[model samples]
Target chain A: MRLELETRGTRTDKGWRDHDGFVGPRQPGTGPRSDPRGDFPTGPEVGAAMPDLRCLTADGPAFDLHAHRAGRPAVFIFFRSAVW
Target chain B: MELQKSMRDFDAANIRVYALSYDEADALRDFRDAHGITYTLLSDPDSDAIRSFGILNTLIDPNDHPWYGIPYPGAVVVSAEGTITRKFFDNNLAVRAGPERLLWAALGEPVVEPLADQPAPLGVQVRVSLDGDHLAFTVQRDLVVRFDVPEGRHVYAAPAPQGSLAVDVTLDENDRLVQRPIVRPASEPHALAGTGESFQVHHGVFELRLPLAVNSFSRSAAPDITISGEVRWQCCDDEVCDPPASRRFELAVPVSGPPAHALRDSRAATLEPNAAAHFRRMSERRKDPG
Candidate 1:
């Protein structure tokens, strides 16, 4: 199954800038990639073999999506925030 | 949060659901405990997996959205054979896929819609009405309520200190409407007859009108909409004050087109004039801007 990933970290390439626009530390990268796909490996699309990726569980355990979904259907939901 | 509610349906379809977020394990645990979430929520603090998904939201300025490494909010359904079967995405950031919609996307079939006509009384001897002749789907309307306390008893008013309970009206979360609580000045300065302690209170019959703004509407062309919530307050007599009391209420109203027969009922129409006056005052307040 195709799964979208949700992001939470605040640090950009630039160290940290206040709302006032004062840049500090490293400058932030434009982060625009010519290719639409950033770093995901190719060939995890429909009718293709699912990619095996290692991700951390919310309870602090190393988990693999394919291993967890062993011989079963699964749905991955990527969302913003529960409280936001 | 709504996803957890449809876990049983997903399970019945042999489809397991997983939610990915940027929150750390500890924060996710706290969120799960607070909301009683039973599904598995994974952590992705660095957003490595999100970037790999090719759906990273790069359009948003990093400075403005530091903590949001959001993936265009969506879901993917995988077959038992590990092949991606379907995907769902929407451009609207404010609206998320509800449980029924998510299940529909996964199963490629229609899901049962939630029922919309449950109604019940919330407050004893209380009345509620809409201020306008016709409800507009895009404009804000007044929900006027008149609360009555039997003679010799009084209920605390706004700004009532921590020790006393104040009359409160809380609207349940709604997807179609944005609700704002009502604010009003207490009746003429007075104190309890026995305590002699100074406090603003509602006695006999008094009115409160709140604003409900329409954000988006359901497909139903009929203006009928049901609002559910609770009213909490405490009453005090000359001798003793009773413990705090609360009740659930469901108020259904016609939103557009023709008004229902109940709206024309003599008892219901009595509060419309007051609602109109309240609207006038509100408009004046907005214009003055002092």
Candidate 2:
């Protein structure tokens, strides 16, 4: 099923203004949609296709999921800390 | 005990057990050494694999800790075709996808067994509240129900001492709980307590208290304070105590006062195309084999 994965670091400006009724001037180079390409500085754009990459095994061998999947199914076990 | 026994069974079956994490190599090595972990421990420091799987959640603040901005904890069983056959996701860190269930899925089998005139202990409700650096909560009766044991059946004591059953209460963020549970042990020790205790009992009621570092709580006000946690323990009556089970629960604690002044709206920073591309590229590089 198609999933719309929200980009990791997209920010919204809903609470930008202060209580003094002063419409804060957009900072230079920080206008609405400044980076029209949707490339977020803080992190990757949400929903963008993840790039194909390889992981180096403990034995120093590199393993690529896409390459290994060469038609076979593979499980991408996601974990926060390899140490955990 | 049966669950531990089951884990031993799985270990003997030659089924692969891969424990994935975002920790650095050194840290992983240390963890393996400390736990004597026999399973595979894989590291994903860049979180590339987690993000690609569409299981990342950036909104959860890390309470200004150094180890922040990691992917949510989850497990997905992928078919031979690379499609996810079964997926388990947890925003809270303390919760984990059951290893046995995952193994069952990998083997294309149903993990849960049918109730045989006796129901397994089920955790129905959980509540967590921040008491300074400690988290206190109660597991209602319904949540602690276990199968009926015959008149003579008994189980071993929980990991804690005779009176104190140490039920390790951990946060959803997976932060190690520093505080010990305020375990109120039974007044009488089971005949089995010392001499190779086989059966234990958590009769009508029990309470647990655990300590956590205060800094784990987020300082941000707009987002509201939320706490998630899990309990891993086995319950048994007189007859039979089913296999061990782990249950996860979450609670949201609201901050009373106005928003904190230190909280800044970091949204003003513009998205940098180059930076985003760089991160994406880094992610890809980490995942690529050649």
Candidate 3:
């Protein structure tokens, strides 16, 4: 049986494993693609000013990263899903 | 919610934390309440912020339900002036920089634990320890090698002048351990008056950290894993140079299981009974192309 990988998503009998070993249907490279192997881009270079992030807070309020944190040092994380 | 465990410390240091995901606001709200996570959780369901940041995971098809709109999992540490200081992007999505690592970036110093009472040393002292109590799958912890040089003596830094060995750490061949390059403390400039030779050296108390994580494909789910490695260095004083030195280290660290959501008996599962329903809703909602 031919196994599909990467683009178009992979499906299999035992379940597909993502770059990080997250095994599940439609995975092996699901949400938060972990495989650092391929041509994946990690955001913003160091020493550059961090651009503001505009999004909705979990509380449904409109949020701006720079506005929210004020001048405090911050650790910003981009993750997969909370549901999954 | 490992971040929850250190929220007080983060707050005490005046460092704020925020995590973003493709999850909808409602889903994030449910996750926060269930997990008792006090830190901010931002919802980027449209992935606009993710795309703007140039990290949208383009490998998955845009139509992929629930998986679409996710960013390459990583962390960016920003200074109080909004300048990006350091970025932690592990090749594997399962792994993330440990809290201590991030805190170190924000606070400008390693999160040093109290020194264990080790035996007295003959010359330069070396002590190896793990940053955290256990090594959890995908969570990167540090193997910290601390050095103590005698008052007038110092250890060579990287590029130890010709014919000399620089201080370094090398882990034994282990498929279970995913490793990152060594994080060395800044070295001070040293000059030799007699020969007019100059080099970088480290004196007093300093540390070299090696960030490491255990992949999910570890051969066994054994409770404890042995991590063995070697530390090498050369020390010198103005008048005398000590012979090069090396020390082998072995640490039997405990392993933590995968994330809480994957376990039935986890505290998160007990607190969030409706997590499954929330996940189902999330899947169904994504079925509709927007």
State which candidate has the highest DockQ.
3
Residue B167 Cα positional deviation in candidate 3, in Å, after optimal superposition:
2.6
lDDT of 1 by residue, B202-285 (tens): 777676666664433233565677777877788876577788888788877766532211223454235232333333443343
Q: For residues B26-119, what per-residue lDDT tens digits would candidate 2 score against the true structure?
A: 4455545543565556656665655555444444333312234356555565554445566555322333434444656656753223345744
How well is each residue in B166-259 modelled by candidate 3, as lDDT tens digits? 9999999886777877899889999999998999999877899898888655546688889898999998899988889999999999887656
Model 1: runs farther than 4 Å from truth?
A1-49, B108-290
lDDT of 1 at B157: 83
Extract clashing residue pairs from model 3: A17-A28, A18-A28, A34-B93
Off by over 4 Å in 2: A1-53, A65-77, A82-84, B1-8, B11-14, B60-65, B109-290
Ranking by lDDT: 3, 1, 2
Candidate closest to the true structure, highest TM-score: 3
Model 3 alpha-carbon drift over 4 Å, by segment: A1-34, A38-40, A45-49, B110-122, B151-164, B173-176, B186-205, B217-224, B236-243, B262-284
State candidate 1's TM-score: 0.43
Per-residue error for A84 in candidate 1, Å, reads 2.8
Could you list the iRMS of every candidate? 12.7, 12.4, 3.7
- Each candidate's fnat, in order? 0.52, 0.24, 0.79
